[model samples]
Target: MSHLLIPALFFLVILVGAFIQPAAARKPYASIPVKNLFSYIEILPPGSRVLLAWDYDPATQGEMQLLAQPILRHLQRKRVQIVNVSLRPFGPNVAADAQTMKQWPMSAQAAAPTEFGFIPGESAALRALTHSPVIASNQPRTSARTSGLRPTDTLAAFDLVIEFSASFANSQEWVEQVASRTQKPFIVAASGAVAPLLRPYQQTHQIRVLLSGYPDALAYESLLQHNGPAHRQRTAQTLALGLLLILVLIAATRSLLRR
Candidate 1:
């Protein structure tokens, strides 16, 4: 039947394309956004405190994991104190995976970023951040290992805030509450679908750096001169899309011949 045949054929094409690596001849263009991000990240002095908000769950891990990996590595390389907080339940796990995969803290003495765990109330929690920095998971800050994350410290103390979000609502919360109050610089690694939605804020310069989807991730990887999972995913995606178009043309031609 045509129904079964079409899906089977499409699956076959994608299977073949996944194994076929895309050509590397195409020059990867690093965009102004990525460059701006690099500049912002580079300007931070060593030991600067950063608030990293993970607002997406595991559902978007495939897209976000690669994007966040390089940035985390770069931050670790700079020796900044990273404080991770999450609105989504699964986000902390993803952040842990990213740190482990990237092998951050190159030195044994360097401690991993403090994980504040998940905060339940989205808008309310963000509002609390303005009033009280330690909203959820108020662990003791006694250890020098906390990298100066004292219980008394407010969110304003952080040098910068970077949010990796998959949802428009999550990004909006950051824009409205976090950005409005602190007046601190913000960087976002957003899912492609949500990137356009956040552009208006970027236009006004509320968002300092915005990176969307696999292409931007690949571009960042290229800028880092480190070929990683994003490169592999891009190759597979390109090859599969190319093959899919060819399949469509062939199907159309065959239908015309039968007619």
Candidate 2:
């Protein structure tokens, strides 16, 4: 019973922390990459065109969506012309769901993104986009038509390119095919599992901003001055980790005293 006390207490603490509200006044530590991402979006003109690539599927949607929501909100606030595209088949549906959940007001709905839906060729499609932005006529459209994406428009036409990627290969393809060719300001919000592999691109300056994992998401939300889901999740995570550390220290002390 004595040996089980620490584990039981730690579990109870985590359970309670999940139900508690995060302290609104607590400031999140924003990293340099997160700050750079915020600056890149902040300077965009109201009508600037942005290419938003949703490259993740439902398997990684849980993390990808949390990272995407705040960034989407920031883009909407900037009032940029967003052109949505995807390399993954399930990506278009996921992007559509995110847009629906974060729908703009009736007045601003006219300015919502133009969905190009899923582009099937992956790396080959990205290479094509460098010269032309048009998707195949057979591809399904998910949203209302917008004006900027024309048959003649190329990848360079967009002011910025942002990709929320789950796969290292897909993100790498974008870096190699589109971003390197167009020389556009490329931003990638990748999953924690894939982010370390992408660091080389960021180091090469091919990716202007790279945001990954819950810490960066929480930091980005802090920079936006919005307490969203990341904040609540981070609070719970911190509580659980801190409690575990304390329990470990207590157990070590007890063992030392017995010795």
The lDDT per prediction is 0.78, 0.81
lDDT at position 167, candidate 1: 92
Residue-level lDDT tens digits of model 2 in 1-259: 4666567667756655554435565677889998988999999988888889999998998899889988988888888888888888998888987887665453273376787778888778887878777744224432424635666667778899999999999999999988889767999999999999999999999988899988888888888887767887877776777677666656655765565
Top-lDDT structure, candidate number: 2
Candidate 1 collision pairs: none
lDDT per residue for candidate 1 within 116-224, as digits (tens), equals 7777788888888767666445445443247665556677778889999999999998889888787678899999889999999999888878999877787877777
- Which ten contiguous residues of candidate 2 have the minimum total lDDT? 136-145
Cα deviation at 219, candidate 1, in Å, is 1.0
lDDT of 2 at 252: 59
TM-score against truth, every candidate: 0.77, 0.79
How far in Å is the alpha carbon of 189 misplaced in model 1?
0.7
